[model samples]
Target: MARSTILIADNSCMIRKGLRSILQNLENSEVIQLIDNKEDVCGIVHKRKPDILIINPDMLPGDCLDVKRELFNENKLSLILLSNRKNLKNDLKADGYINYMDGQNTILDMMQEILNKNNKSSFPNKNSETISSREKNILKHIALGLTNKEIADQLFISIHTVVTHRKNITQKLGIKSVSGLTVYAILHNLISMDEVK
Candidate 1:
């Protein structure tokens, strides 16, 4: 198993230290960087290219959409949002979110889940095929509990096209049930847990 590298970015020293402590228990994982300022995040992420990034969007300037695009587009890494806000903005694309008040066990479990998913994706099945970006979009919508018609309407595509994409997704992933596909979407970071219905 490859070593999983994680970067923590938060303005709070206590939160950073606490998250570091909790992450220390993860097997074959390393906390590569602890960033306290938004100014240095992009540069560090570009250089280090950690496998996972645990960051607070508030630490970044503006809406952080530019940072998200730069980091995510450049690297295939998991982005976990660290926030205590009751209502998180939907614009921030994150693989997961950890509340400040969450217990250590819950945090650990979330990390472990991300690690497990990372591992699985790192080495996929030999016969397993990849899905296209369009299919992924449809799969994400499906996982979000959208009906076929809803997905078609949202994507501005015909219902027949949506159905075809869903069929292709099912065949490629070998997952027929919606629940199974939802799990796949969540694990693959296509959609966060909060987004799933």
Candidate 2:
């Protein structure tokens, strides 16, 4: 069982302390950092590369999309929106959300789900054989969110060859989704998160 590293970013001291206290009780979870301002969130996140980041959407700097893109490009982590409203903003791309009014059980359950998903995506198939270097190039492109045609053109290979390599990569890793492959690539150091689009 892998431990999940968590970072809480909120302007409110009480909110940060409360979340940290509640999160500490979760099994195999650690509250690694408590951030009080938005400015430090991205910098710390890039440095620590926590497994989960629970933050208020308002804490994000300037344009949310740009900040999110930069943060995710550097670190593979789950983002959880922390808000007081029951109806969360639909625009934010987050794994989960925790309301200020939510009970301890609700928070625990949400965090657990994020942790489970992270663990599943982050770990690779142990019994699988080694991937060929050519297949690895394709996997890196796939993890970087490149289309088959793009990968084929970039590698000077046919689209059919790219597809075949993708199939082989999936078979070897037992990971079907692009997101899963991205996580695997990051974990294996096949591609850095900074390279992800």
Model 2 lDDT, residue 78, Cα: 80
Best by lDDT: 1
Provide the clash count, candidate 2.
0
Kindly list the per-residue Cα lDDT of model 1 for residues 98-145, writing each as its tens digit: 989889999999899999888888766523579999999999999999
lDDT string for model 2 (30-110, tens) is 999999977887789888899888988888776565345666776787888899866675666677889899999999998
Sequence-dependent TM-score of model 1: 0.59
Model 2 Cα displacement at 119 (Å)?
1.0
lDDT of 2: 0.85
Candidate 1, lDDT over the whole model: 0.88
TM-score of each: 0.59, 0.59
Pairs clashing in candidate 2?
none
